[model samples]
Target: MSFVAIDFETASGYHPCSVGIVTVENGQIVDEFVTLIQPPNNSYNPHTIQVHGIHPRDTQYAKDFGEVFPEIQKRLQNQIVVAHNENFDRNVLIKSMALHGLHYEDLNIPNRWECTLKIYRSKGFKPAKLSDCCRVMNIALNHHEALSDARACAYLYLLR
Candidate 1:
């Protein structure tokens, strides 16, 4: 089985400030890509900064999401994408791409994505935060770090 696990950290609202991608083939992670993204503008919310510890200054020299999307699509196109919270990540991708005048479908991403958060909840785990699920599954997590969260999500999905 081949799939890509992804996670996004936002600077403010739905603006993606960074991305993480872990590509799994035959159930093993084969590659990983993580990068900070310069959003359309350098505006970051303090609350979001506290959540992900990413500030505008950190991404000032980073590529824009538009510049980053090609690599992301190369990893994810026609592949099953997994995220801890599919809705939020998907929305972030959509909104951020739109801000760059790109359509989400233009990336040819797979429609059938998996949500590990929902998976854990359906398995009778309450309050399936990424950290909570990681604890239950003996997976290591660094909470809101995009790459750490994506890697944890990939491990969680493989265990399932």
Candidate 2:
């Protein structure tokens, strides 16, 4: 079965923010998508050169969640979506998407999910953080961008 692993890098902190996705097919990453979304209409912290490494000004040309989610939905349709903390990633991202008036219920795909964090824990692994697992698994994930993180999650999903 094919799957898409996803990760989100918020502006500063995590929660209620933008996100990205990495889709894997045939043991390869077929597509990568990123968006500069307007946060929960609340506030956007700092990700400048850090997690997302995106400055607020950089998002000037990028589309908000409302504009870009259609593409995200197209790719995710009927695909397995795996994440480190699958529920959290998917939930937060779903909520983040909602900021633009979109919801998972609006999608045709109905994503099937798996949480690598839970998987590792059930296997007696000590840590479930993507970076930590990548360290142990020898997968290289760049600091904190969405694509890199998603690829890392895909690698961990492979372990199972």
Best by lDDT: 1
Q: Put down candidate 1 lDDT per residue, 1-160, tens digits, no spaces.
A: 7789999999888888889999999998999999999877788989999999998889989998888988987998788899999999999988877877888887677654799999999999888999999998999999899999999999999987
The C-alpha lDDT values of all candidates are 0.89, 0.70
Kindly give the stretch of ten consecutive residues in candidate 1 with the minimal lDDT sum: 104-113
Q: List ranges where model 2 is wrong by over 4 Å.
A: 12-18, 40-42, 46-51, 108-112
TM-score of each: 0.95, 0.81
Indicate the residue-level lDDT of 2 in model 2: 75
- Residue 117 shift from truth in candidate 1, angstroms: 0.6
Q: Which lDDT tens digits does candidate 2 get at residues 39-95? A: 434346754345556665566556666666677788777777888887767766676
